[model samples]
Structures are given as C-alpha cells and as structure tokens.
Target: MTQKISPNNYLITVANDRYANSTQLFRAAAMIHEVIHAYYHSVVDDNNSPTTNLSLNNFPALYQAYAQKTYPYGVTVAQHDQMATDYVVSMAMALQEYYYNNNPTPYPFLSYEVFTDLA
Candidate 1:
C-alpha cells in the first residue's frame, strides 16, 4: 500500500512485520510481489490519470504476453496473476541462491514445483 506524503511525493513502505518469523522462501516471494508493484507503478503511474498501454500497461515484453492474457479489460491484474505464472521459478532460484550464499556447505536447491501450487 501507498501513503500520500505530499502533492509531489508518495511513500511506499513494506511492513517487515508481515514477514517476521517467516521462512526465507515466503520472504522472497513477498519481495518479488512488491518489486512487481513498483515496476507497474513506474510504467503506468502518470499523475492522477494513470496511463495503460496497448501492451498491458506497457509492461516489458517479458510480462506483456501473460499480462495481456489476464489483465481485466486490458487494464491490469495488479500484475499478480502474471507474476504468479512467470516468476515462480525465479523466486525459488533466488531463495536457493540466498541460502547457499549464507551457508555454502548446505546447498539449498529447489525446483519450480515448489511454487506450482501457489495461486
């Protein structure tokens, strides 16, 4: 969520409390979701009248296909549906890399199947 700080500025804050005691996997997923939100905001947010493109909010090619498929009325799904379908393996791999970096002895490998059940 966003809080309007002033006419020319906005503040977006992630509540780390939400991830307190959460596993690294979930933490990574949350981070990815927020990142997608940030990207969407960057692309579409234009003053008070946000502009969406023919490419489904002008999302890059990587996101355009699935976004066009799932965007309601060619608007947006808040990028969640596309994120779910496209970034699962990425999130899992990120988690694995993070764990390995923290503890190299125990390779924390995971398959994309770990996230297939989500959504």
Candidate 2:
C-alpha cells in the first residue's frame, strides 16, 4: 500500500504475509520492489494532477517497459502506478539474483507463517 503523508513524502507498507511461505529469492525481490516504490514515489508525486502537470510523462522508460506499447507518449496515473510496480518487481528480482551470486547473507528471508499471523 502507498500513502502520501506530506507534499513529497510517501509511506509504503509491505505486509509480512506478502512473503510468508515464499522463497528467499521472492522475499528479497519483494523487499527490493517495496523499497523502489518508496524511492520512486519520493521523487515523483503520484497525487499530483496528471492532466495539468503530466508527472506521469516524466517516467518514459517506466511506461515503455511496463505499459502497453500503444501508449508511447505517456500513461495514465493508474497505468503509471502499475508500471512502476512491475518495473520495480522485475528490477528487484534481477538484483536479488546478482546478490545471490555476490553476497547472499543479507537477502530477505521468507516470513514464518506463525509469526506473520500473530503480527
């Protein structure tokens, strides 16, 4: 979940259940995805009026990589958010693979179902 707390600040929450019972790779990827979302939203204000400011157009590569090819110019606010989510998840997965090869100790672990349920 994403929420704008202030003018340029956002809060992104990732529930423990999201990665519960998943693989280490999946957990690491999800962590990266959420972190990226936090970073992206920090720079690009999603709550701003897209029609007036065209904030969505600022992320062209995100649009090209995740959105439909027909929308070459830009994407709607909803499309932009979805594209950001997809792009970050893909990037996170790739990063997780790289970390696995280089340094695997700090990778995210799968949440324990019992603990997650309690939380």
Candidate 3:
C-alpha cells in the first residue's frame, strides 16, 4: 500500500509478516508490485483530485504509456493491468540479478532451476 505524506514523499509498505514464509523470488516480486503502486499514486493522483489526471488531452504522451494507462478502467484497474503487463519481466530480472550478485555464480542454465532451495 501507498500513502502520500507530501508532494515529494510517499510511504510504500509491503507486508513482511504476511509474506515472510514465501520464497525470496515471490517476496521480491511483491515489493516491485508495491513500488509500482506508489508510482501509480504519484502519477495518477498526486493532488488527490476527484478527476483523473491521465487523459489523452491532458497527458497525451502518457495516456497509453506502459505505466500510465487509465482509460476505461479508471486508476485502480489500469494500474494493475499496466503493472502486470510491464513489470513481470522486471520482477524476474531483479530476482535473477539478486541471485547472481549475492551468490556470485552464474545460473547453471541461466535459470532459476539452478537454485535448489528456491522451491
């Protein structure tokens, strides 16, 4: 969840208590999901206005952009849709990089299959 305290500050929270038992990859992905929600909060509702700021006329270049599409579905649905489509690869890449960086080892076949405990 996201809470905006000011123009430039936002509180983005992920439930560690709820997700601590999950795999590292899943926990990492959950963080990316929450961060994207903060992005949505900033881009779509920074001012807390009742009307959407993400329109073709007002924000033409951003209207259909990957992280900025909120047309027929409004802000809520569109944010999730955009995140699901655009950030899945991001989540996987981040998790993969994390595995490689901390372990300092190449993926056996460049796949998570190399991590036995990832299950």
In terms of lDDT, the best-performing candidate is 3
C-alpha RMSD for every candidate: 7.0, 10.1, 6.8
Predicted model with the maximum TM-score: 3
| Clashing pairs counted in every model | 0, 0, 0
lDDT of 3 by residue, 1-119 (tens): 77777654788777778887886666666676777778766664443444655334434235446334435656567777776677666666776776667554464445754332231
Candidate 1 lDDT by residue in tens digits, 2-110: 4445433456676778868887667665665666666555543433233433444334553556556667445356366556677767766665566557655666565
Candidate 2: clashing pairs of residues = none
| Model 2 weakest lDDT span, ten residues long | 110-119
Q: Compare candidates 1 and 3 on TM-score and give the better one.
A: 3
Whole-model alpha-carbon lDDT for candidate 3: 0.61
After superposing candidate 3 on the true structure, give the runs of residues whose Cα lies further than 4 Å from its correct spot. 45-74, 104-119
Whole-model Cα lDDT of every candidate shown, in order: 0.57, 0.54, 0.61
lDDT score, candidate 3, position 24: 63
Question: Each prediction's TM-score against the native?
Answer: 0.52, 0.40, 0.57
